[model samples]
Target: MGDLSGRTALVTGASRGIGRAIAERLAADGARVAVHYGGNEAAAKETVAAIGEERAFAVRADLSTPDAVDTLFARLDEEFDGLDILVNNAAIATSSDFENTTSEEFERIFTVNVQAPFFITQRALSRLRDGGRIVNISSGVTRIAMPEIITYSMTKGALDTFSRTLAQQLGPRGITVNTVAPGIIDTDVNASWLRGNPEAEAAAAARAALGRVGRPEDVADVVAFIASDDARWITADWIDVTGGSDL
Candidate 1:
């Protein structure tokens, strides 16, 4: 754990999955975490309870709406004196190929996955303390093509570019910006098809050199490192947390 006793962090989509793990890890490291959730207030409260209510709080805002994204930060401003870490982990995935995808589906995914983060970071800059950190959650789909999730891959590709450019822009402010890309993970997102089905799970695991699907904690640990002082010199890079998948 890094020395983050006095730091304050906002973790979007922190009510479940990788986001939940990241929020919990940050709190465990001593940073007061703001667990943001779009609709699951109960789940968000559960995360706060796990972190200790005194050290964590839950905030709600629909990231798909631009106005709601603004409202999220406004609420954060009221609770925190200043922001030290911003984790843009909230995203929506669409399982559709070129022929099957619809315009509305693509727009919805991009709105939440790409547009929200861009605006959130822009608004957060004024409140972000110098020497702070920004971590964006990306995916391995950008590197290994998955036609079923083509739109999802495109959103992450745009996010990767955002991270690199933001790192350059924030360098003068002493803030480090980076992206963490994860491969197949045994999260709720894949539980339907990746769990229970031993054959399917095995095939997914075989894609990684480690011969296993990842856990939320696996990616969370990497985010923790990037947010620490040890990674002060590392910025504008994609930290692949894929267990060497497709490599």
Candidate 2:
């Protein structure tokens, strides 16, 4: 059996991008996964099809909504007897001057990026076995301190802090919590504009000392290992999985 054989995992924002990649990797490693999406049901089903019905399940919930958060875990409770891992990967970006940003925008981003994960972890902790794992998908933009992406980076920075404190809290129970920060990943989030845009692509690629943009699998590999027994002793660690990106 693989390291994750027979394990049950829930991955948020799993319709595509890094979240989808994480779901596929865990499934390939033998874990039965619950692929969660906010609104893109079709894309979510596509992910399930790729994983096969036997190894993958699909669930929908807007992470920013309180009711959705509640319903999501309730469904988890109904469908599975236990959960072994959680990959909190759902988030959104709002670009604007600090003064122009709306209160609603702040709430929207924070609710999904920080609040949902907070409550989800709270609600799902009991179902997680003692040896369970939690990996929060954070970003490296906080280090670069980009002005345009300030709010998004702030949310991720909060996630890093959450991983630290939560790991310590869950450590006694043998559940390891950690954060994986990825740099510029080449994904569909901005596929329409980013592709063939030489100036933008080159700018992003230049950030990495490795001199290349990242792939979703790059971050997924880090998450997979963190959820394995090999990382049992690793907790409260905020790991930078960036491709040597500019800091």
Instruction: Compare the candidates by lDDT and give the number of the best one.
Output: 1
Q: What is the per-residue lDDT of model 1 for residues 107-133, given as tens digits with 9 covering 90 to 100?
A: 999999999999999889988999999
- What lDDT score is found at residue 143 in candidate 2? 72
Question: Model 2, 177-210: lDDT tens per residue?
Answer: 9999888888998676677899888987888888
Quote the lDDT for 192 in model 2.
65
Q: What's the lDDT for residue 155 in model 1? A: 97
Model 2's alpha-carbon lDDT is 0.88
Which parts of model 2 are misplaced by more than 4 Å? none
Task: Give the best candidate by TM-score.
Answer: 1
lDDT of 1: 0.93
What's model 2's lDDT at 78? Answer: 72
